[model samples]
Target: MQPKKKIYIALKFIIPAIIFLISIGFVSKKQEEKLCKKIVITIENQQGNFFINEGDIMDKVTKNGREMVVNLPFDNVKLKDIEQRIEALKFVQSAQVYRDLQGNMLIDAVQARPIARVFNPVGKDYYISDRGEILPVSERFTARVMVLSGSFFRPYLEKNLLIDQAGKDLFNFIQFIEKDKFWSAQFAQLEVNKSGMINIYPQVTKQIIEFGSVADYSEKLSKLKIFYDKILPDRGWNRYERVNLQFKDQIICE
Candidate 1:
């Protein structure tokens, strides 16, 4: 091939590649500036009693989110700070604030899912979610959250009411039950006694099944399955006054 012809072909490819890169850069820049053009805050569990307010945006989104806006430009707005503020909200479970491809800022918020009501020894009770989240028990009790009474309640992180490890474990267990369609509406209350024994009270049956501690939780749950399928409905769940699954090998019923 001729040198001039080869050079022309190279230029053709190189020009297009550069133009494409420039276009992408421009698009990205616009996204950063256009983020949050119209802020939309949707509360999934805010009504009657939950303390979710416009002021909750502070710890819920970070810094002063009320004053923040979209299409204003990314240089002026701090993304990390805004995220922190939104997360600070008590009812907010998770938050993600980012600039979309078109340079539009979208603040995505996920509110915590409340599983039960926790009564504390400190004379305080709060709404407990399957994700190990807690909402203060204020004057409002109109929401349909179930109640949980136990010897153990979650300890919070410094000044922040985020639940601790034990609370998180309890939350995971509740999530497991709710995820299963068979047991979703069966449970009414989950109680932890003074001896750290875990008990479940089903709404349909007045009897309480004593589950011992969090250790071997899966094992105890498996035993319950057998009892439910093989024993309960066939023999009548009322056959046992107190169902104990604390032992390693067997379930002893009273």
Candidate 2:
């Protein structure tokens, strides 16, 4: 090709590239100058409760008792700060704040789901989230979940419960029960002894279930189900005061 033809071809590509960069910068500048006309907050609660609301999030997205998102330019809105403030709430699992092309500030937050309510011996009652996070009890709403108590839970107050082996077993046990429709409805409360042995209190039956350690819990629960399905039907519900499922493949009733 001739030198003049090659130069024309290069200019054709470079000129459009420069114009594209300028167009992007101009659009970004316009977006920054745009004022936020509305604020939209969305809370994801598929597995969560009404522990946090729109008003609660709005309280965090403010400066000196005044709303900071609406009526402010996009450049002035501190989206990161707003997200951090909302996520600081006890029930909030995560938060995301961003501005759209329509000059609207949007905030999306996910709330933690409580799987069990723990009534510790120290008198500090709190809820355990599905992910094993310790959440403060909300006065605004009460969740109907499995109740866990006893002296064995004291260590969780000072240290991270989810990290410990015993805590992981306990969490898994609770998940197992929660997933089972019959077991979840039958058992209401659980008490753990110093040796980590769990005692279950049934909602319909008066007999106490001696569920020894979290080890082989699935097998023990399976045996307990057999007792309920076969033995309890023939021997009456109140025939035994205690049902021991500690021994492997055995249901000791008294």
Candidate 3:
């Protein structure tokens, strides 16, 4: 309870607290000192528009191609705005932006996948993906995807994409089929009959495979595999020009 003893105890606690505070402040100061001088941005399948918009935290930063080094007075530079701006492109599917300890920023993203190539009535040819999506041509991004033919082939209107009930059914059916792993790579194109019936044409084998609808894509795909692995490999593509799997658990190949 003596005054000097009480003072010494207080000094022991206060000295350590002050030293801890000073160490934290020094580390923080060093982190801020490592602030980046610029920001780097790169986009894939960008058709020439490469400028990140203003109000972005990365503006006025130094750019070395896609690598941006942002000059930050603080330890962090918020980059959500910059990412959103870059991903606003109709062609861009998703965008990711991040900053390292050195204030270096990176933008990486993958474009959307196109499902079907369409021949619109406007005499313009474009591609439409599985989500009922449509887009113009791209020389740089022509995927080895599927081709579709029906009355649904046309320009993208804000209205309905299907020309009739048949087109809609066929689109849905083929989209599911396209997602199939065993059959998708083997299939080349899909054609819709006026009766809303679906068909699968193989990439290696040239034949018209008559599948009813999306209802039996899994089953029909299995049958198609048998036709290719068991029959087509031995008999050649011309052996079965018309492969029909309309009946239950049966594949009638002619």
Candidate 4:
């Protein structure tokens, strides 16, 4: 083949490749410029009952300042950093920050579901999430979940989550009551005494349920259910001021 003909053929391929690369670079630059326009925050509170709002997430994103990431360059907005900031919120269970194809910064977040609220004698309040995580109460919103009070020590309150065995037991108990249709509405509060004995306060009946310990809670609660469904209706709700289910196999009514 002639050298001139070889050079012409090489140019045909090289020129298109250069044009393609340049076009790709231009399109990418335009897309990035579009992404730097505005940020869109979307809060996915699936149940609509969770405490976190879009503003709560935005507060973390901006740190209550405009220059942080809002209306800033797309490359400057770190999705991982935003996610970490949102997840740091006590109520937030998980968060995801990303950029869509439309060059818009999108933030999706989920709030932790609180199963119960714990009120200590020292006036400190904490929320026990469904996953057994202990979170501080929100200042903006108060969750009307089950309230637990009495004798929780400092060690239990110091951590952001339940680490001790006793705390875990209490967490499990509250979670169980919250999940159960009959118990969730029936029980109003849970009290843990210094002796680690658990006491349940009912919503409807004045009778106090003495649940001694957390072990065998299912069996103990089942016995109590029998008393409420079978015995209480016939005997009258107020007939027994206290119902004890601490024993091995007995529902002692007094």
- Which candidate gets the maximum lDDT versus the true structure? 2
**For every candidate, C-alpha RMSD to the true structure in Å:** 9.7, 8.0, 8.4, 5.3
Give TM-scores for every candidate, taking all chains together and pairing residue i with residue i. Answer: 0.61, 0.84, 0.58, 0.82
lDDT of 4 at 25: 100
Top-TM-score candidate index: 2
lDDT of 4 at 98: 82
User: Candidate 3: lDDT over CA atoms?
Assistant: 0.62
lDDT of 1 by residue, 1-254 (tens): 99999999999999999999999999987665555555545555543445565546543443454564555666777888788777766667767777755566566676665656676766666776545556666463435655667655544412222345555566677677767767666777788764456888888776688987877888998898888888888989787889899999898877
What lDDT does model 4 reach?
0.81
Superposed model 1: Cα runs more than 4 Å off:
1-37, 40-80, 98-105, 137-146, 154-172
Of the two candidates 2 and 4, the one with more favorable lDDT, higher being better, is 2
Sort by TM-score, top down from the best = 2, 4, 1, 3
lDDT of 3 at 180: 73
Model 2: per-residue Cα lDDT over 1-254, one tens digit each: 99999999999999999999999999987865598888899999745379988889889988536766677787787789889999999899999999888888899999998888889755668888888888888889999999998887787863446988889888889988888898899999999977789999999989999998999988988999998999999999999999999998789999
In model 1, the Cα lDDT at residue 10 comes to 100
Give the Cα error of residue 200 in candidate 1, in Å.
Answer: 1.6
